[model samples]
Target: MNASADPLVSIVIPVYNGSNYLAEAIESALSQTYSNIEILVINDGSTDDGKTERVAQSYGSRIRYFSKENGGVASALNMGIEKMAGSFFSWLSHDDLFVSEKIVRQMDALAHAASSESICYSNYYVFTDDPADTVPISLKGVPPEHFRYWLTVENVLHGCTLLIPKAAFTTCGTFNTSLRTTQDYDLWFRMAKKFAFVHVPEMLVKARSHAHQDSHKLAGTALKECDALLSGFVAQLGIDELKAGSGQPGAVSYARVAASMRSRGFVEAGLVATKLCIKHLSGESPYTKVLALFVLTRGALMQYITKPIKGLIPPSVRSTIRQWLAGGTKKGPPGAETVRGMGLKEKFSEVYDKNIFRGSKSRSGEGSDLVQTAVIRREMPRLLRELGIKTLLDAPCGDWYWMRHMDLPVDRYIGADIVEALVAKNREEFGSEKIGFECIDLAEGELPKADLIFSRDCLVHLSFADALKIIANFKRSGATYLLTTTFTARTSNEDLGTGFWRPLNKQLSPFNFPAPMLLINEECTEGLNMFTDKCLGLWKLQDINLQ
Candidate 1:
């Protein structure tokens, strides 16, 4: 802890209106076990009736105080960087506290690391009001190579946990001021690219997660600005032949941002993001660019076709015609009963091929494709927006034809299906930062949690027993709502030669489910003319009071 022998560490606390906990944050840094530490509090124009300024003034000469005009956190940090008198830099937020031994342990790790340029960070504890609520976090299995990939998906690194060498700043530069929420994330990515980040898997800081934090206040606008900053960062990476399409790191990030924008009704922003992705990916993925344009055009055609078709034929007649064309009385497909008893994974793998929807028959809604593309394109997004759903789990995302065009007002989209090849192709071609694909057998495996579970025309293809099991899984999946279209004939579960068909109401009947744990309320969709009895049921689960 000798000042002359040890590297001087600067603990910069950036504050705005953080009068409540600023003193506590400052004291924690001053009491650090590593004595050769300088504490600098940057007051980024606090308008809290001079309260924050007073708090810093009370610290006086013990902590260096600098007051600047109202600037963002990035600017305050940059100012601190310029004035810091230490070779090692650490960011201690005005609301967060550094453990007494945080620096001592980090320095010990760096000494062993033997790399002058290596950045060191440690796990931290997240707490609200109660000490019992503290959760120790350790980022496991995260080496430097995988760090970039994991960071691209989401920012996992905690800011206060970081202990950066001054050389890293000189090499990678400081935070981006334009970025609101993800400035720390941007800086991490920049430094990670050039320097190795050594992880200390021990809790070295106490991060406060409170209501008044900047992140919580600007929650809605944060993602939009973060994506904007990320788009610019990726653009600067300069795509190469080796970095095209999903393989291109920058392209992958852009596509994800675009998908999120599109899902949230920011069509123009999404289009711009898509354009950026195409620009980076076009050099190596010419077909992918063409495919994007083709999907756009096909969406327009489907929208137009469905409008006229809806007007010409009544929905009931359309339903009747569809049934008759499949030979009306067929008992299901040839091996329907055999497939019914098969395991969900094997059954879907054998029957639903990767390119099943690419076939002309599936595209034109021939057999088993009960919900029309028009219904999905027109109704689904509106329904999602109306329900204020921000996350969606679309199982059996078949070709994802209608979804590409729909204005789904969601923040996250996960496509899960039983088809392995289809899931792989989706991961390769369409996976982005906010969008992902997983191969899951609905009857056997657990479903991802979301605000809504969207499975249309999928459950009806299963036998009554298997379908019931799937329903039970959905209830256990912690989803609030299920938006699904069930094939109904006011009858019991029967083999209609196309697959298993059952009455929509009967399947969702409260009496059919287990007691006390599940309370399902079903409401049919109105204004859906075609296949009127082919009802869209919104089933809401109260909760699963698991005994």
Candidate 2:
């Protein structure tokens, strides 16, 4: 294939006595859809006669061949980096095959990227010799820039899955020759600090899993290296990174990381990580402390249960078991269960008990996705500042899952819900001197007084009479203002009973709320844009017609 103006990406295959699959690996590099590329085969010293050399020679001038003492993969890779003519570098293991479109797709992604040193990786397939055993792994859908934050827990990024710019190697330096087991990740960690890595979300490489791999043969060494790597990584890990990566408080993620380290038999490293968890937990509110404790308990439970069960599985069926588990990672759209023939208290009780609103990967539902709440999160602080609002009453605050991550500057926060059990859980896990949880059913009696009522995603589910009763209750509370959910695109109102739901335009018909003081678009992207213009509007309570 003729070269093009596009930047050259060197496909570097470092082999050590790998004639068994060297030719296949070379063939994959040659078959790339991207034409602006060069193939470099580094035959790291092989003691298996000249079989590996013959394999490299058979490729002729199609690949640039070089041989050296078996210094290790890191050394071979460093030699390839020094000798490669391409501006970009891609490492292809002698045993792994790249999908035909890997380079071309990554090149297309880089064309749109703003930074020059930015590296890119993609999802990939892992398999044994049998093609039927292939399993596609999906990486979490985080934006390219934020990947480093989440990389704390990500272990699946294979060397072959990466298409890296050569400049990154120059800037971050090549793989550590001294490290035998973790050179790729060690260098990647260094580069991750200095460069932005993009995730392409497409499966671009098929990795071969075999028993002869170093990780399988030298398990002790690999575990030690992994623990060392984690030791350094955990040392630098701080609250900001955890919050950015997980959208949760620092202590929760720290405890999880600690639990993960301990479960892997790195007891000392795990203890250090636990100290970091405790350091962050120090002086935090009771809510955060309880939440961290809850996370730690859950992690402990998982460790106790899964570790034993994993051991009990037969080696013969481990492959089948893994395949089944890989398939289980995918979750379908959450089913919205019907809550029919139940009382006001029983209706919401069932909703919480059954978790009927499990709409997104988030436990609270799709209404609470970080992206869905992005607009409102940005707007809330400003609204609070402008109104001088010191306290907030979050009605029907189910789970407090998404909101707990938010940093609201309120003097006091009262999370109220209809489910008594949910309220108790919230109070136990999230209540503190400045934060509180209450069992409240708005359809009934007088509401608690607050500077403003931040009632979101509430009115749409209630009957028209119940909504009126809640609105009257809101008025009776003598709160200065209300910020609540409304679908502005909705031209008319459709009334439903307490257990059912449809979009309601508060400005129309029976409600006829005046033009809102502020219409903060919820930017509802939950389902295929069906609920567009669903907004949280702000209004002064006295101006609201309570009749």
TM-score of predicted model 1? 0.49
Model 1, backbone clash pairs (residues 3+ apart or across chains), number = 5
Clashes per prediction?
Answer: 5, 0
Candidate 2 RMSD to the correct structure: 23.9
- Candidate of highest TM-score: 2
lDDT of each: 0.65, 0.75
TM-score per candidate: 0.49, 0.54
Pairs clashing within candidate 1: 315-530, 331-497, 332-497, 332-498, 333-497
lDDT of 2: 0.75
Question: Once model 2 is optimally superposed onto the true structure by TM-score, how far is the C-alpha of residue 231 displaced, in angstroms?
Answer: 1.5
